[model samples]
Target: MTDQAIIKTGGKQYRVAVGDKLRIEKLTADVGANVDFAEVLFVGAGADARIGTPLVEGAKVNAVVRSHGRGKKLIVYKFRRRKNYRRKNGHRQPYTEVEITGISA
Candidate 1:
């Protein structure tokens, strides 16, 4: 029953609370699917927080997938000043939008 918790996903960690909306790396769940994050690193509010050695045992985060989409395109360019070499590329990373529904610890 903490106000916030830190959960890990997609090789990254995020501090989140109930009702928070965030975009995370692409997930396999379909839109509107429920997802649970079990790799909780920390939980609780303020001084009451509990931090895990690597991951907290018996801690989890519940969320609902809002959507799946690609992020804004990013342009990558490479050039050689005197070699007349030029290269350009664009990339869009896929992501999942989710809303924090609840946390259990």
Candidate 2:
């Protein structure tokens, strides 16, 4: 059986395995904290397996918080061709990086 699994976090789903590094939306966990996600929307072994109606019970994804940081800054600009209206702005999104330790099904 494969050790890979699909789990949901921060309103998004990710396919992960042990030792995989992934970046998701901003999480409240501090660095070196352990986080477990129990909401498993899908589970499979090889090419065939069981699927949950909503979520599979007893499924979990364990991970460790590696770091907290901000993503690349994005510039937002708006201009009007005929009018003299212009606007420019920059935004940096907060994010968290985590390492998958284990996935159980």
lDDT of each: 0.95, 0.88
TM-score of 1: 0.94
In model 1, residue pairs whose N, Cα or C atoms come closer than 3 Å (at least 3 residues apart or on different chains), thus clashing, are none
Residue 47 alpha-carbon offset, candidate 1, angstroms: 3.5
lDDT (tens digit, per residue) of candidate 1 on 1-105: 548999999998999999999999999999899999999999998777889998888999999999999999999999999999999999999999999999888
Residue runs of model 2 more than 4 Å from their true location after superposition = none
Model 1: lDDT of residue 84:
93
The digit string of per-residue lDDT tens for model 2 on 21-68 reads 999999999999999989887777766665777898898889999999
96 Cα displacement, candidate 1 (Å): 0.2
Q: Estimate each model's TM-score.
A: 0.94, 0.89
